[model samples]
Target: MLDMLTRWYQRRFSDPHAVSLVAILLGGFLTIYFFGNLIAPLLVAIVLAYLLEWPVMQLTRLGLPRTLSVMGVLLIFAGLMVMAIFGLVPTIWHQVGNLIADVPNMFNGLQNYVSSLPERYPDFVQPHQVSTFMITLREKVLGMGESVVKGSLASLVSLATLAVYLILVPLLVFFLLKDKEEMLEMLSGLLPKNRRLTSKVGAEMNQQISNYIRGKVTEIFIVGIVSYITFAVMDLRYAVLLGVLVGFSVLIPYIGAAAVTLPVAMVGLFQWGISPEFWWLLVAYGIIQALDGNVLVPILFSEAVNLHPVAIIVAVLVFGGMWGFWGVFFAIPLATLVKAVWNALPATEPPPEEQVEE
Candidate 1:
């Protein structure tokens, strides 16, 4: 066992560069695993800067100074943020408060409907079964209500942290964009001189991650705006709220859309029952989803995220378990990073067989 372990170590770590690479990877994993929350703002800033870098570069190419380009990009970003916070956020908040206030009524209606299920479908559902299911569902709903309350309290406590992130992230993004090359130089200085593999992997990851983040942000906005307009035209209640849900539903790919559909359908059912309006709303919503899956996704991610559906789903589950929302949001790019590293690393060649005299 000792001999085998020794041989394995010798075979893998014989090169000093390999040892350095292993150390770097381990150190990065540890840093992220242990202090991810603490450095979240920095990570967010980095991602935002990366997303904005293209526009900055385009401006520079058009005869603007790099500093001016960075400033222009930052100003545009700040304006959008201001619009979202002032214009969109308040409406969403108002709708959310209304939803919360209506929860009791929703629950009561659900309970009544469930209680009637056994009578409506006597052959399919039994009274006892319906009773048991309703009891369990009530408990789950109560638990969820408690969780919401706790989460709201937690958010209140984290307002200071949120404020810090809001102030620091944009500032960091500005500096990162303004001194991008200098920062790259400083980071590269820490690595071994001969780091071809590292550089290759980094470059691949940079391109993939940039495309993914930019495409996703664009998708969210387009989907949200379109959904909002569709719902408003349909005279749907809580149009903004539903549209936002539909928008962010793209984040988790297969799962988010399916999960969000229930609420949307439920809202439509409650408002219009099994009427033409309900069917029409669903048809329009379905068309949006179909177009997103078949058209928008392919266009936006044409050269980005070549992951299979299974791989993407696995990435979402694994990373989401580890880091919640951001983990889910970044699963594809992180998976791409893994794919990049795997492709960058040199494959081990099998030892040649020695021929014996016949």
Candidate 2:
């Protein structure tokens, strides 16, 4: 047993290219396993870099110093964030206050409506089932909201820290852009000695990843702004907020915008009372999504994320089951990683259809 194990270890360590499969598998396993803890912030940093680096690069090309370029991009994004908060927060707060004042009436109306349902046509859902679902849901979010209230002020305090992190992200992005070659060399050196092929493949993978990240960020911004503008014109409750949500959610692909639509649309329906305006709000979202799905995403994600819809969905489900929102956020990148691996393998000769099993 010891001799067999020793031989296996020797074979594994002997040839770098031969061990590629093992290394890839182990690395993937570790990334998936430790992703939420080790990867989330690093991924966030990469995203911020992609967002800021375009203007940074352009400015550099136009004769600004690289540091000055990064600084300018940082300032612009910061101003936008500040403007969004100022414009959106107070309105959302007022809506929340109004919603609180209306909740009891809404609950009473809902109970009356449900009570009428069981009486008007029996043999279906009991009131208890309805009550149970509501209880479970309230238990989840309000229970979470309790934590939110307690931590709200702390979260406000974290703004400064967040700003610091944002600042760091662009700085890191600038350095990544400025020292791209040196950084690649240093990172690639992590492979075993003489692993030239492995290092070259790894560098190629990183290049794809960088472009994908950059492209997706641009896609999100475009989708978000378009949605926000449409919603604002319709005067939807928290239009800017919901727009931000949709735009941000659009980054994740299919299910991202849908999830945002639920709470946000509910808020609109709940506050606006479902008139033509309410229906228009729903239609507005459908149109925005159509625009996004038909145009914006196709243009941006087609190259960056070449995976089929089924593959993208499966990645989201598997990753979401494993990690939740962060999983969704990372799905495209993960899919791209899968595609890189799939394409790297040599294609097998096709079997004759006649000889294949029925």
Candidate 3:
């Protein structure tokens, strides 16, 4: 067993570049795992810088100085963020308040409907079974409601931290965008000199992650705006809130869409009660999802990483469990990084005797 382990280690880490790459990767994983909360603003800034870099490059190519380009992009980005915070957030919060106020009515209606299922289908749904299911569901729902209240209170306590992130993130983003090359040079200087494999993986991940972040942000807006417009036109209550949920649902791949469906359906059911309007709303909503999956995703992600569905789902589950929202958001890119590193590893050749036998 010892000999076998030694052979495996030599086969994997024989190259100096491989050792360097492994060391760098291990260090990064350890830092993030240990000090993620401490450096969260830095991470957020890095991601925003990546998202904003494209526009800065565009302006620079159009004869603007790099400093001027960074300023222009940063100003526009900050303005949009301010508008979202001041204008959009309050509306969503109000809608959320309205939804919470209506929850008791909705729950009562649902309980009544479920209770009637036994009478409507005596053979399929027994009264005792319905009673037990209702009891379990009510408990689960009450638990969730209590959790939400606690979360809200916790968020209130963290407002100061949020303000700090808001301030520090933009400043960090500005310096990052302005001193991009210098930062790269400094980081490169710190890494081992024998890092050809690491450089290759870094270059690939740079393009891959940039495209993924920008494309994902664009997808979120497009879906959110379209959903909001559709819900408003159909006179659906809590349109903005639901639209936002549907938009962000793209982050979780298959699971998000499935999960958000319940709220949308419940709201519609309580409002229209199996009427034509409700059916039409559902049909329109379904079309949006279908188009997003079949159309928008392919177009946006054409130049992005091409991961299999199972691989994508596994990445979502594993990384999401590790890093929560950020993990789920960057799961595909992280998985792609792993794949790139593996592919770049030097392949060991068999002995001449084995080659001759073959």
What is the TM-score of candidate 3?
A: 0.94
List clash counts for every candidate, in order: 0, 0, 0
CA lDDT for candidate 1: 0.86
Best by lDDT: 3
lDDT tens readout by residue for model 3, 269-347: 9999989998998898899999998899889887533778788889999988887777898888888888888888876
- TM for every model, in the order presented, reads 0.91, 0.73, 0.94
Model 1 is weakest, by summed lDDT over 10 consecutive residues, at: 343-352
Candidate 3 at 8: error in angstroms? 4.4
Error of 1 at 79 (Å): 1.7
Number of clashes found in candidate 2 = 0
Candidate 1 accuracy as TM-score: 0.91
Decreasing lDDT order of the candidates: 3, 1, 2
Quote the positional error of residue 339 for candidate 1 in Å. 1.9
Cα TM-score of candidate 2 = 0.73
Model 2, runs deviating above 4 Å = 1-18, 21-25, 28-41, 63-68, 79-102, 119-171, 193-204, 272-275, 321-326, 347-358
Which candidate do you rate higher for TM-score, 2 or 3?
A: 3
Order the candidates by TM-score, highest first — what do you get? 3, 1, 2
Better of 1 and 2 by lDDT: 1
